[model samples]
Target: MEFRGLGFVPLFIALWCTAWVVVSYTLTVIYGHAPLLMYISQTGNYYPENITFKIGFLGMSNATLVLMLLQYNFILLHAEAFGARQPMIQRILLAMGITSCIGTAVMSVFETDFYPVTHRVGAFCAFACGCVYNLWQAILLYEVPGIRRAICHIRMVSSAMAFIGVITFIGCRVSVYTKLCTEDYEKIIEIISISTEWLMLLLILIQLVTCFQPMQHLSLTVSRKGYTICKRENQDSAV
Candidate 1:
């Protein structure tokens, strides 16, 4: 069955992603200027208490990431529980679960400055899984013999997201290793940091879009296959 209004799901996610961008820009305007100074002095020069801006910014960004992670988690769960008819989906679920776990651990390390390693590892795991899933879906779309056009569209979106994910993951690693905006490379670092944050927003947008695809697919499938709809609805609603 053809899915109608599926485009709206990704658009909605893009709208939600705007909030993170706003928060990030606000933080940049407020406290992102002299990160090196703050790092050295271990305090903000002006309105020291406003350091909350950075914390709040990070919190909002992390919250966005967590929301995306939860969405993947739900998809993985569904694949495991109800996708026995599609065994390839089971492998996707495993990849999603592994990446989600890594993402969760990296996200949980907000208490320390040493989260760089955790973040890099988590991003790598998630990026790898995204690439694998996208490639698998792309191949499946070609070989399945039906719904090739629709799956091809999904493949395009998934591959784009995978590319963005890998780039963002590598960017994070570069930011960590290079220590941008330090006394030595002050200007370069600032640009890199801001660019990293912007890239992060894109990654979040892609993840959210990817998450909503499954819901739209399920909705369309149920609408097309009425007999399976009842059983599918019962099973999906339980999730």
Candidate 2:
């Protein structure tokens, strides 16, 4: 069995998820229940697991995971074909990405209201490791010469922006914990933190969006009950 032209799968999934999340959060706010400045996963915490959690949150998390999986699959092949020396780093990044994805789904299932402790732990894993995933990929991209033409400056720039966002988020939490922030100050920090988080994710997805230029011909052929990158000749093969 073979799957050709599957490159856009991740890109489409990213776009769909991003739009859905914004729309879901917008609806939640518009309904006069959710507050003005909402966290990305805030809507998911609504009691009874509203449609936002079921479709928007779950759908976005899983879809992003699938997209990352696909992107990393391409990265592995791209590295192998290009002769990247550090296989260990790429493997670690891939593993961290996969783990974060699983954590995202798990966190979604156990909302913050229902299971605060467990959800916080899972969120930490998801976002913390998620940062590593993006940063590491950017590292590899910079170190590897073969993908320079395919991966433009946007990848590097976006990765840096995402890292800045993480730093801002952590800084906000630290300020609050140290009693350095007043109630109003904390609220302002939270809003900035939320915006940064969203921007980081949006940029990450945008990086994937541009990936179509180079890997749009990525072949996903089933082999030995797994998938392998097939050559152009196998483009039209069926199961």
Candidate 3:
């Protein structure tokens, strides 16, 4: 499947997560230098400034792993929505999960450029994903006539999470630009980072909420199957 359009979902998630890591590292390095790092200089001290860069890059790598996990769940959710029946979806999701995990492991071993410009590819990918998912949900709501009635709850939740993603992207970009304004622009960046982090976190929480409800429904359905199987077994024994 050409993820040309769906590519952004993973991309943006990476960007938001990376930004969180970088900003946090920046705060830590600056704070470590002096109580006044927050007041005077945005880049902190010069000699050991590379430490923040290393720390931020490490944070980015960790966040990417978390993003990959979510992507696995997303692929499963995609397969389920497309009607893979139980067994097929399970196998497909497992394969995709394993592949993504392995790919991430390979990437983790390398040390490469961590500049924002280089990282913007991830940001662009994230924007693309967010937009595509929004469109997909809209299509699901309007075009897919079969499950419209049944999926009202799903649509509502998906719409809310998608909206948050859009808002988070805009907020993060603005904060990044603001950080470039002056020497001591770090404080404002820190504030903005905290806000965006919470926003992205809210998205994570929403995903968790969606994940559990479906599993709950699936468990109930499986229990019904178990009951039927047991009943048939007892009847055969009686016969």
Candidate 4:
């Protein structure tokens, strides 16, 4: 069956990843302003500095908005799929997803150079909440009928990778902040930290792809009251 609304997930992933790649490359290679191992936020630190900074800022902001819309779609898909019989776990997942989306927006808006504290808080919320959401989602999917076992396995693996990435990223970041390593060691630690951050982000986006199958049979409609998601009838039959 043709999936409706699956485009949102891919669009979110593509926009963010492209932004990161283009901005990071421009700063490190073309502009020679930032180191290769600099944090993602560093690429967009001074928005007035260059066009790449503006692109990074705008890209992340737009991606966060798309992420929020994707979360809403997931909530509606769950509501229609399970109806009133939906479990509390589903509600909790929806809440976590929304919280992560909010965190993403905050992080995108508050650059680390200008708003260090707020940016850190937003990053903490986005990564921590998002990691928990992925693990919990994997567990919940096991209980859901008709979901493929392979998808559940993939989710579980992706969640574990994200969890590991978070821990490694935190450890390396803390080591750098504390000056626990020598000057030479600091660069290595920084590289590891940045790499893990990228890994965590990519895994989070990958996990969202698992939802595409579940959403294949669903479609959204809007009426005078509000928006509603409904299962699509077989197109062949309608024809």
What's each prediction's TM-score? 0.47, 0.80, 0.36, 0.75
How would you encode candidate 2's per-residue C-alpha lDDT over 1-239 as one tens digit per residue? 87666756767767776776777677768676568776766777664335656565567667767666666666666565545555666677778987787777777777777787787677777777887787767665554333445466777777777777777877886787687999878888878878876787687687776556445546778878777764344433311
Which lDDT values do the candidates have, in the order given? 0.46, 0.68, 0.41, 0.66
Q: Single out the weakest 10-residue window by summed lDDT for candidate 2.
A: 230-239
Residues 1-239, model 3: lDDT tens digits:
11111233334444554564456446646557533323212232333544444444445445444444443343344453555463454455444434433432333222223344434434344333433443343343332223334344554565565556556656655666666446477566655645554464455434433333222211111343352111112222222
Clashes of each: 1, 0, 5, 0
- Model 4 lDDT-worst window of ten: 230-239
How do all the candidates rank in terms of TM-score, highest first?
2, 4, 1, 3
> What is the C-alpha lDDT profile of model 4 across 1-239, one tens digit per residue?
33344445544565566666665657555566667666776765653433455555455545654554554455545554554745565567667766776776777677787898898887877788778877876765665555679988998999989988887887887787888889999878877888888777678667766666554445567667877655556533211
> Who wins the TM-score comparison?
2
Positional deviation of residue 125's Cα in model 4 after best superposition, in angstroms: 0.6
Best by lDDT: 2
Instruction: Using lDDT, rank the candidates from best to worst.
Output: 2, 4, 1, 3
Better of 1 and 4 by lDDT: 4
Clashes by residue pair, model 1: 181-189
